[model samples]
Target: MKLKFSEGVFECIENPPQFFASLGNLHDATIISVARTAPGGVCFIIGDVFNNFVDFPEYPGEFGAAIILAGSTDCEWTVSASHLFGKKINDFEVFPAHSADAKYRLEIACHAMDRYVMNFDKAEIRIAR
Candidate 1:
């Protein structure tokens, strides 16, 4: 199954929440695949990290991730990696495109003790299949 994010909305590609045991916490190690839509939206393909693990704050257990899209002028977004599981991973916020006709850059800001990590990804709006 896949989780899709587009046009400020999130939904599962296939199957339902019952397919997974539970949504794990954030801060867990996970890989997310992002795709750019034609109309300026973003699609994320999040896969499982473990085969039988579930819940948050448990090491080596498999859990999903949460994506919080923020429109911050300060150039940072926050993600709670420790609270991922049984929930949709796609989160989005509206932002200005780099250019009038170009795709919008989705900025991610992860907060740490002293500083933050800034990452940029772009997306377009479209229907999910």
Candidate 2:
């Protein structure tokens, strides 16, 4: 499916790993941490090695990238977002235009062969490290 992010960023992914890595040209993305915010918000940390590309920054090393996930008004989670690490993104829809404070509209979605599901209303991806 097509992954639509803010700022006219859009790309097609052939696999789950490619989906995350393709976010803003991120490389070697690995879930470093996950946390809860607000009343029911979750933050998924994806670490990436940046600045090695030709157009990237001078520094080259691993840094903490941000993928903040939250809900509009009390988001629900059938499965913890933290446990999604290494799970295949079977399918997902990221409405960047409607996403605000991490708002991501859903129409029946799950990743990792239906092993995990997090109802998020807000989502933001920061590829730069």
Best by lDDT: 2
Model 2 ranges with Cα > 4 A deviation: 1-28, 49-63, 72-82, 85-103, 106-115, 125-128
RMSD of each: 11.4, 9.3
**Judged by lDDT against the true structure, how good is candidate 1?**
0.32
Q: For model 2, how does the per-residue alpha-carbon lDDT over 8-126 read when each residue is reduced to its tens digit?
A: 23222223334444443342334466677776765555555342232555544445545555564434456666665643333343333244444344321333433333456545555
Q: How far off is model 1, as Cα RMSD?
A: 11.4
Error of 2 at 27 (Å): 8.6
Worst 10 residues of 2 by lDDT: 7-16
Against the true structure, what is each candidate's TM-score? 0.26, 0.41
